[model samples]
Target: MKSNRYIMILFFIVTLLNSSCSDTFVDDIDLKFCGKCAHTGRWTVDSLDFNPCFSTQAECLDWAKKNGYSDRGCVLCN
Candidate 1:
């Protein structure tokens, strides 16, 4: 019957809409963007220890000290 075809078309349209709607959803994401950088003399020994991209040099140093790093020097970079 024509009603059965109409129902099938509606179901197909609904399925397509549901599948396409998933693209607009976003999952949990943590992002940090600090316009400055920090550097210590430890980069020569270990490149991974040389973490930069901080809001300020002092903040970077504090993080280093808390993590038991001997970062006695700091310099901000762009």
Candidate 2:
């Protein structure tokens, strides 16, 4: 019946949408603008590590220090 075909089409569309909506991990991503920035760090659950190659390293460091900052990988400046 036509209803069966419509149901199949709807199911297919829903399947495609769900597949496209999957979340991605941040480490798998790269950028052209911030590739050279030092503030582009990623976080672990317990600590912050420096990512010197990222253009946003300074920003990331600040964010970590203010928000989630820990001394796990920090080098003392003082």
Q: Which candidate is the best by TM-score?
A: 1
RMSD of each: 11.9, 9.6
**Every model's TM-score:** 0.31, 0.30
lDDT of 1 by residue, 24-48 (tens): 3544342222222323222121124
Which 10-residue window of candidate 1 scores lowest in summed lDDT?
Answer: 38-47
Q: Compared with the true structure, what per-residue lDDT tens digits does model 2 show for residues 1-78?
A: 999999999999999988876557445564333333324353222233333332234544665566545453332221
C-alpha displacement of 57 in model 1, angstroms? 1.9
- Model 1 lDDT on a 0 to 1 scale: 0.51
Which 10 consecutive residues of model 2 have the lowest summed lDDT? 42-51
